[model samples]
Target: MASSDLVRRIVLLVVLCVSGGAMAQTGQDTSLVERGRYLATAADCVACHTTDPAKPFAGGVSIPTPFGQIVAPNITPDPDTGIGKWTDEEFYRAMHEGVGRNGENLYPAFPYDAFTKLSREDVLAIKAYLFSLPAMSQDNPVSELGFPFNQRWILSGWKLLNLRKGEMKPEPAQDDAWNRGAYLVEALAHCGTCHTPRDFSMGSDESRKFGGGAVGSWQAYNITPDPVSGIGDWSDDELVEYMRTGMVAGKGGAAGGMGEAVEHSLSKLPEQDLRDIVTYLRAQKPVRDPADEKPRHGWGAPSEDVSAFRGDETGDDPDGRAIFYGACSSCHGMAGAGTDDGEFPPLFRNTVVGARQANNLVMAILEGVHRTVDGETVSMEAFEHKLTSAEVAAVSNYVLKTYGNPAGATVDAAMVDELRRNAGEQPLVAKLAMPGLIIGVIVILALVFWLLTRRRRRSLR
Candidate 1:
């Protein structure tokens, strides 16, 4: 053969060798991607990432934040619209380091604080899952935060204040179940996102921990071990039942964002994983916030008499009557007779009215009742702000004295002021009390600074 022909043959061989090496790398990448898929599922990536059924992972879900509204972004492998061209290192930086593919900082609205506990390998697994999804062409609108918050540079400063980088550490003292739960809660489940309180600066209050925080229109309750205000009152069986079925006897059912979380993410958790979460939470430190422990109404105790005003004294409170007619008349009925709304438990029925305490009744008025909706029993909205305190007192007293029993004490204007003050000061310990036990693990796991970040310099200051 000629020299030119021989040289061409050699070049072809070199090309084949390069092609073979590329294929091998691709195979390893595919395996990692598969692992990431599982991790993302456990993390409930779909809950916030995908808003439209036609475009999965094309994030545009509007999440309410304390400062403003945040819109999640499309994470598919779309070249123009998603993270399609991002390198593995870029993905790692985003997850473990809280940086974007372009080297800019990410907003903590993504819950990277909890995700920081995720191993690099685990984060890559999630990236793999994200890349495997069908790319969405639709572009999402930017967030609707106010002026200063809308600036991306501000997020970097926020990260400096709050962001941490690390992986979850196995607690040696705890069993495998607790360890697994800690991992899930701290890394994937991120239960503290809602249960934990935030400082005025909007960072998680490490001091108060899962003490509670107000987010947009909703208030996150405390999940500590306080008996009167926290889960100390909840039995293990009751906790399990709530996680499994989303119902608690007196507290209330899940509604709003909570209901969505239960349906999209929690319902998919494995039974063993759920149990682990419960175990880890049950083992947490208890909080002692007396403000959270007090009952909704000070019913049974021999406190000041609120029975001075029974019904319409002047008969001029039109708004009060209208509120009662529009909202409370269904199961409560025109005559306040208990209907078939489950044991529609008469409003004036039993100790709720007769007890010296009026807190139980006040909470009921502020936080409206919930029953079956769309054939499913769902939690309803609390209308504390919707109606005036006198309206609440008037309607409450009307139900108590007229419908169920005469032994019930009447509610008054002064009593309304006291109830509002108490309700407004609700602690995080109280909110976390009603949910599953995993809440505690999430709160505490965030506190383990040394164990989480393997490298000292890698830690969040």
Candidate 2:
């Protein structure tokens, strides 16, 4: 080993030796909060939990699902409004069994299924780290769920079917790097919570693991080793670069939840850890989708049509070409070629534009792009307020045909309007919740009336 590595190890050993007894007694080391902080970042806890950076982890951020919006609760150490009173065991149960402090069934929205894979030591460490933060009292917003969704009892059934609690076991045959990567990917990172397709009950489908799933307003594309449908076409370097930098030009760029993960979690990870992740991903079974005849990022070409721009005064009707020229052509060239350095990516072959669906492309227009890492930031301005729904659809369609996959031209003004309203595909539970609630209510009312009538009749007799 290098001299620097030896020195670092020695220093760590000395510190542990001095503090080990206290650590064992308290089951926490304040000095160890740094480790907890790193793990929390790996879990990307702040992304969902913190709405305001000033009051970190005083959660009220709305996490939108097809069923409804779940407001993340405050995790800061405030006794009244947060988890300050929770024992380490209580916190562990919440993580390991999806049960809250008061023994309430917590929502799957907290992603406890993945957390269940975390070891008790790690869970406590995360808690210790959270507790180490400044306690801030912030009342959690009640979840805005419809009908039966607002009921928590159903989560018990959901858990029985889907929850698998266990620490990640190392594959004996694999190297240490691969094992570490597996734990990081499965437990801390919980990539499957977003990247894997969901079953009928809205739990992840392990059969089609890493086959591609959807986050709100964006599709999490396949990352398995399938050439056409997944990242098999990408080099190891490309994958690592994308994880660290959030964009590997001419291939894919992160946006939405993926962007958040990259910016907050993946980008901060050590290079070796990123490589290990790539290594583990490389070993996964390649899942191919018949729909992908070509790569999602493989389609598209620079536009050659200059004739459409010759007209001077635009009419009342929304013109996509005119809109794109007015707004987009400055950063991305008239020919759709970005900068030589790819600071502004070329439209052609962008993963967002050439996706199987146009949802992400539309979202990108509305949300824009801003990912910062390594002291550099890549940005795009959001046009949601600036552009009308019709104009957004028009421009999206125009980009699709001229510079991206023509099949992605499915966006219309109505679809854009709907996306603005609610930005996710309806899950099975969401589809059933309304009818289920109505039937349940009717049954309860009938039972109550029958009981009341019988009691009155008996009393009269």
Candidate 3:
């Protein structure tokens, strides 16, 4: 071949190799972004960050806290209103140290204490996935917090008390699956943020890990292996099925935060990952409360009140049995034995009904069950508008007596009224905050009145 022809051939080979290398790099980037998206789902990031399904991660969701409502910040790639300008280092810091890009302290509500355990690579992968999304430019509203909480500077002191910054280390004795489960549970899932109770300063009580905590308007049930109060008797399959679909035959259903986690996160996760989580939970130290009773799913039998509905259709008296015939009987059956396939789960042997605390059950009645698994949405219509509070209480008591834990059958209209306030109480901080604010206002008015009198006397002179 001529020298020019040989040179042309060599140049063509170099161009093809370069093209192949670029294509390989793009493939890797796509894979990383996909992995990050999975991790984001596992983290249930959408639960707090996105209010509207159409504009995910744009972060205008309002999270109710004892202090006040905490608004989720935008994590989308909008340079103006989102974290688009954030460097990988800044993102990692937010995850690992509970610190924001501008070095502001993030509230514990974000659960950075758990994110702190995530590996640097995992954190960056999550960031990569977040950045890959369409840059949403919606502005996040300021968190509606009370005095001390609104003062971001106070959060620094909170961090010192609660934050534990570091990556999770694998336990050598455990097998790979167990270790994987541990990582997913302790870090990515951040289950402790909901399962573990908070201390006085509102930090998760690590000592009481998985002992069950309260979320907005719902109780995060005890997941510890205690036989009475927790899931000790729950078989691995039961736990897995419940986590995967928010429903397991004769066990319980997930509602509130748990329902969201199931629909958006757990149900979509790889099966092995879920099995690993169950393994880790099983291995944790069992925690039991002194007031513990039988397992939540171990309560009740078929309602004998079946006889009440058997008679002539009762007059429009809105008592528990009357309401059950009218509203509940169509799905749950007259015997309270739910549908054959467990589509409509039996109120008996169910957590919401059998739980010692009536909060979750009442909330469910008012708000109703809504969870999606495998792209199918399962929902129960909410009765907040349809039923009076007294009617809710009556039906709740009847369900508890006939089909659930008789111990928890003590619900009343007054208790239902309280639960109607969205299932949470004012935090100690907010409870104290309002009174202190009132006192401060009174003192300021007194000072102003004294000053006005002094000015009047001077004018008279």
Candidate 4:
């Protein structure tokens, strides 16, 4: 061959080699799809995507972010409404590069940063499971973001600063179980999406990995191995039970977002996987000591603060008596003998009063309870509305102090404000009457107008 021809042939050979390797890396098969299914579950994809059972993978689950509400997109195999038409390469690009099928950058709400740790093979597995799901032709409206956040181009700049592109690499020093747990927790599970704190710019602060996070309406507590502020004191079994059933022995049961996670994802996981998670958590680095951290003045105490709130106020105990008579006595009974069949269970006998930590009572009181009644969730109606923060605090303090357990924490007014803020109650409640009431009235007026018009037409005939 001539020199030019030989050079061209060599270049062609190199191109083929690179292209072949790329194809091998992105290849999709049955096994890969199955792996993806497992990964998606581990990542809690269903918790957000398949929120409404009737609308599985159809997407309309609104996730509250500081910027605005973000809705997870349909990833099912629907050509028009889902990712049915997306090429394998396109899928890879989205998972690895954080770019959409058409090259638009996806918002970090999808947690591609942590997902970026997943191998191409792992991401492909997730894609397979999503595609295998029954596709629905639902078109969820895009979020109504305010100001600069609505711009898609801004995410490109976000990528430049925060996105670190790579795959998971195991720590060789760790055992196989620990390594597996680490990969699942840090990458597939994307636990950091909720647990890790974010900076002002809206990216997770790696320095505080597994530290507490305050998203729009929910607070994801720190799960670091910290003895106080984190899960340092929890045993392996406690961790497993918490993950599997959303209940820990002394720490209280899961509620809110955590409850949902347990119901959808964790509950279905194999026992071994739960054990691995516990092992991994136990081995994690402690973020902070609870004692060293500043004490939160208001919220229900974790146990130690009970005495300060109690004092030598036997006379005030009757005030506690009156409050209980007014509110709790109906269900719990005046003598604190819990109701039969564990329904309206006694205050003295209940786990909340007996818990080593006070989070259960604090959360239950602040958020309130709802037992399933006649196929519908019957809410007991939270006193959060009727009772003052101080009143609620005082009542809770009184219950723990007098009835069955030691005194409750020093949950003052300021603590109430903080909890209310964290729950996103104040903002939503303030606007509830404004829009709903007005809309209801308008709907009634429109119906009346239609009825009047129909009557006039009949009379004319």
Which lDDT values do the candidates have, in the order given? 0.65, 0.87, 0.87, 0.68
Compare candidates 1 and 4 on lDDT and give the better one.
Answer: 4
User: Model 4, stretches more than 4 Å misplaced?
Assistant: 1-32, 289-461
Candidate structures ordered by lDDT, highest first: 2, 3, 4, 1
How does each model score on TM-score?
A: 0.65, 0.89, 0.90, 0.67
Clashes of each: 23, 0, 1, 6
Query: What is the lDDT for 38 in model 4?
Result: 74
TM-score of 1: 0.65
**Model 1: residue 288 alpha-carbon error in angstroms:** 2.8
**CA deviation > 4 Å runs, candidate 2:** 1-31, 310-317, 440-461
- For candidate 3, the per-residue lDDT at 104 reads 88
Better of 3 and 4 by lDDT: 3
In the range 1-461, model 1's lDDT, one tens digit per residue, is 99999999999999999999999999988888877776776787887888987888899987765345678988999999888999988887777767887777777878888988988778878887887788888688887765445667867767788887778888788899989988987788887877777765567877866655544334445556555545666777766655555554443344434555566666566778778877877777765555432421222221112232243466576344445556666555554444455334334323344333445556667765453423565444577888788788776765554443333346777777765544233334334433534666676786676566656666544
Write one digit per residue (lDDT tens) for candidate 2, span 1-461: 99999999999999998788766866547646877888999999999999998999999999878888999999999999999999989999999999998889999989899999998888888988999999998998799987677889989889988999877788999999899889888889998898899988998899999989988767888889888888898999999999999999888678888988998899999999899998889889999988767888888888855655763355765778877887898999988888888888889988878777898889889889888887888899999899999999989998998888888787888899877854488987778878887899999999999999999999999
Identify the candidate with maximal TM-score: 3
RMSD (Cα, Å) for all candidates, in order, is: 13.6, 7.1, 4.3, 14.7
Say which candidate scores most in lDDT.
2
Q: Give the TM-score of candidate 4.
A: 0.67
Supply the TM-score for candidate 2.
0.89
